[model samples]
Target chain A: MNLKSPREQEYIQQLSIDCVIFGYEDEQLKVLIPKLDFTGDFWALPAGFIQQEEDIDEAARRILAERTGLADIYLEQFRVFGTAKRSNKTFMERLVALNPTKLDDWGLDLNTLGWLTRRFVSIGYYALVDIHKVNLQKGNIDASIQWYPIRELPSLIMDHEEMIHIALDTLRLNLDQKLIAYNLLPETFTIKEVQELYEAIYERPFARNNFQKKILDQQVLERLEKKFTGAANKAPYVYRWKRY
Target chain B: MNLKSPREQEYIQQLSIDCVIFGYEDEQLKVLIPKLDFTGDFWALPAGFIQQEEDIDEAARRILAERTGLADIYLEQFRVFGTAKRSNKTFMERLVALNPTKLDDWGLDLNTLGWLTRRFVSIGYYALVDIHKVNLQKGNIDASIQWYPIRELPSLIMDHEEMIHIALDTLRLNLDQKLIAYNLLPETFTIKEVQELYEAIYERPFARNNFQKKILDQQVLERLEKKFTGAANKAPYVYRWKRY
Candidate 1:
């Protein structure tokens, strides 16, 4: 189905919201990306336009839910991309060329095409979700939805790579003050897992002793029962976020 | 002159930029606001619409320079306010009521009036400037431009009050990491003065010794020759930002 129909043109123009959904598993930081079905090689962050009646935050939440099948996740507005030439004219041209019949089938005329392909100021939002719990949905526009490791991100469409960098920088800056990492973990997990997440984000290994001391000093975690493993001498205790 | 005219209708639609200009003086945190000439009781942050050819950051910088008469100041985009109801209906009504003759005088018809008062998705940028250095300009729309202490801010038009709150929260969050306080200080200042600025921002007092140690440890400051006071045994050492 055509996402941008003539009916949608009545909504706010030239504003869009893109989600940089971050997930962690297998000791790697990952980002959720949607492969464009029409372009075959192009992948983009899950994004959508805001309706006239909806709040921008609500639009972000809707996009997140539509792609990941999750709602009320930890979402933040990090930055705005409002450069005059943010939309790649070459990419749009290629997209148009590749899907001329499809565009006609969807009732998109030259006017609608021009409107759809114009430069947009997108508000970038980042979401943190537990990789294990999310029920990912392959939306109509995407050929497939999958998480790619942050260290080896694929070439993304239209300044999305820069958006990801800004999101990571914001996450790193807020890591301590806000309990953001907790969203990426299970309800209960070992302190070692938490340390690994931090190390992956910062791209540096923390000394075991010092990392434990620093996390404990934050006083935002509660020690829980030990996880038993057959080969372990003394299994490390698990932790749950302490209610403030 | 009507800020919104047929000429301005050619600019980018649905997007605007508002600046929360912060300043420090008299041991207080203050924000720059302009009193609307049309609506006597209404005040707003210095703001403008994004032009078709200008980058959003450049739009922000232009607005800042236009209002404060200072260029190349420390500015950062903090958040975007995109609720559908961000522009208060009551305030717009009052403004229209007070400026009917002016609107007619400037050739603003019903369509232009409706367009001017419609909801906008504003990108919020915050700036820190030396209060002493700003050459405040009372613009055509504003009756007067003045700095109001953050704690005792007058009731502002639209969501500007909330914007100020968010700006302060963002500033406090980045205070330590970015050495943002230096932007609010003069080129040279005493340690005690620095402490007072922090105290004002945080709304609390810091122990003299601990504050001194903390500021000194940042290594961003350079101690200079003491300013002599006739009655003092030893004057506090003046410090300036170290040249990078």
Candidate 2:
């Protein structure tokens, strides 16, 4: 026999999503995060609450498209963060500052308000999109959006900076396996440029001959002719992804 | 300034823990789960509601100990699953079958009984422990505990099965990095044994010479002069992981 009513059950559950967007360009690895319109222009990763009818993955895709104007990009679930203090005082303060009217406008009760502000376990997904493909737009909660080179990111809300660091580490470990698919580069790039991308991520200088030999041995890249660049004595040969 | 009373916050805020317990032995990877006693043997991953005044990780660790007698094992956050449907229909049917007295025992309101089921966004963490180390026990709500190898599993409650499969795939991708630390092997074993383990996971017959070369190149293992069993004459060299 059914003991409880459905309405009470419905009121207790909640769902949300967080996205880690990676972009490779300008010899720097960048992550796309929401720039909060609070406290002299703060920033955080783009995230949102899920609707009753929407799927989590669909929510991620929708949010990515809404904020970046890109569709069909390579996005994958990474890890979930569900700490008790997911939105601690520091985080909610920022949220409140971002939009003063949000709480009252929603007519949220103290309990409902706490549930919204309390421990949230968010599924983290990473999307690798070519930097050129993104035409970034502000989120509903933000007045502006931008891609900051990961190395030079400003202080982020909550533990978002830590989240980005973890995402980058994940990329480094799975680069060989995951590199085959996602389009984080131009249609074609030089060996030097590719190496530079790795360098930016690895944050170290790699031996040139050894690096080239290692990648070439993987048989994952195809070479293309290089056009003269007038300034250089010889144009480096360009290469595009051969297999994913 | 904080707007809500602590009592009001308590009504809204809560914590919980879930475990994906993985075991490997006899050439198969398995997950430990339980059958709900109240729900006519409906299945679920072994989990528990977290108590107040406990850290999130502590809650997971405590649950692991109370359920399985396991302590000090490698546990990593995988992903959280929190869809509204996660706790709908099937869950309550199972719960009603398992706990006829839950509503009365918990002092839950008849009118708001279903709503008390509320939304739970679980933080999923996977623990890799030596199966031998677990002191598995059936809980008050569970009829019995069981281990199902990845290849053979019955219909799971909610998305628990999907969660296990995802964990398994992640484990495979992480095998090389985790070979030494994850207790995927005995303290000492022959190269042939290690090869067999990998072959079992990859589900392919790797070329012996190539496999040996790759293993040697990683410098993760150290060869030993000792050999075991009644066939030492034909046996390969014994090897143990070099401490990381």
Candidate 3:
């Protein structure tokens, strides 16, 4: 990836945006992590810097669209990562040790990153996209972007891991609203399906009864007719999110 | 009230911190606002800029300590307010129109705020302070710091009002945890007290039955023996947050 052109433009180098776009498929919660290094080792969330004219959220949306070629995704600003120690120095050291190519347009080494060495306080945004839609090749999306299960993420650069964890917690906190907002579930679904989705999201199992009771407590669901089954008493009720 | 000194330091000029410190008194939720104008009218949240060496969170804590003279308060990083149109220009216009003195040490007019006119995206932090504790007169707290009920807030500067609203929403989302975290209530309180606290927080009334059910669902509270003396069933059960 060329880092030279961003400086050529009027990008806000000291502030950046990192997006953790989460998708669910095959009962697994996956996050889109781009391999920023040619060695296929260094990974980071889809990130970009803000331009002088665009808003921070606009920059995040632009970066997401650039990577996935989609829009109107479920996105939320979770938190900002601005520790005193959060600078390019650590990443700078990593790049130097790994010896990645294309340092800059100039012959400057990693240590001489100049103003690039200044601390960048990144604004973290997390998006919940329908996997089938964003992963579709129909859009002007990059074919090289990869998706990895959130739990199985490779070692990420910077504080992205911490960002993901906080994003996950925020997701869990607003799971009901997000599910409703994005139509994450089918129009109607059984308790088992919802439980499976929750399990995929939380990365843990839930007791059937406990799951049922808690889900109902949210009042986001309205019970529909039960699914008729050959086995008596085994038919579970189908429910739809009361999106009112 | 003075903005001249911050520029003299190695402050992160383009990024700032705005705090929405919520305190409860007499069953009313109040927010701290500092009047920034000599006109004694222009109000904004207690805010400051991050230093080059301090962490963002550290900057917020330091600002809180500087204003309240207290530490270890319940603080949270909710969201960052970074829109394209955010700048000191509007505030500058207001200052110029109002004829506020101390325009600048350099006699620069509002039109030439220089880099200060560049969009300053603020990280919004919120704190849940015990009104009595922070309002105490022991620390290096500003004597003129004022607390206004959320409902009766004055006209705010920039996007501080929007910041405060979102902070309150975040507060409601984590009310149970925040309450328990801060020991916001006495060691033991009645269901009515809890409901009142919720009412004060939510700034709305809930049917007694509905509020009780909602509070119980959180499961943060444990019921204690009924206070004897009143007519039998009229006496309510005492409750305490189950810290465990």
Best by lDDT: 1
DockQ of each: 0.78, 0.23, 0.62
**Tens-digit lDDT track of model 3 for A151-209:** 79889877889999998888887776545333455457787888888898877899999
Per-model tally of clashing residue pairs:
0, 12, 0
Give the range of the ten consecutive residues with the poorest summed lDDT in model 2 chain B: B1-10
Ranked by TM-score from best down, the candidates are 1, 3, 2
How do the residues B87-186 of candidate 2 rate in per-residue lDDT, one tens digit apiece? Answer: 5345765566566776556554334444334455566777877777788887766677888777788677777778887766776788787563336566
Candidate 3 docking DockQ: 0.62
Residues B179-227, model 1: lDDT tens digits: 8889999999999999999999999999999999999999999988764
TM-score of chain B of 3: 0.78
lDDT of 1 by residue, A73-148 (tens): 9999999999988764667678778877766777766566566566778899999999988999987778888999
DockQ of 2: 0.23
TM-score of chain B of each: 0.92, 0.78, 0.78
Worst lDDT run of 10 residues, candidate 1 chain A, spans A1-10
Candidate 1, after superposition: displacement of residue B37 in Å? 0.7
| Candidate 3 error regions (>4 Å) | A1-4, A104-113, A135-143, A177-192, A206-244, B104-113, B136-143, B177-191, B206-244
lDDT of each: 0.85, 0.68, 0.73
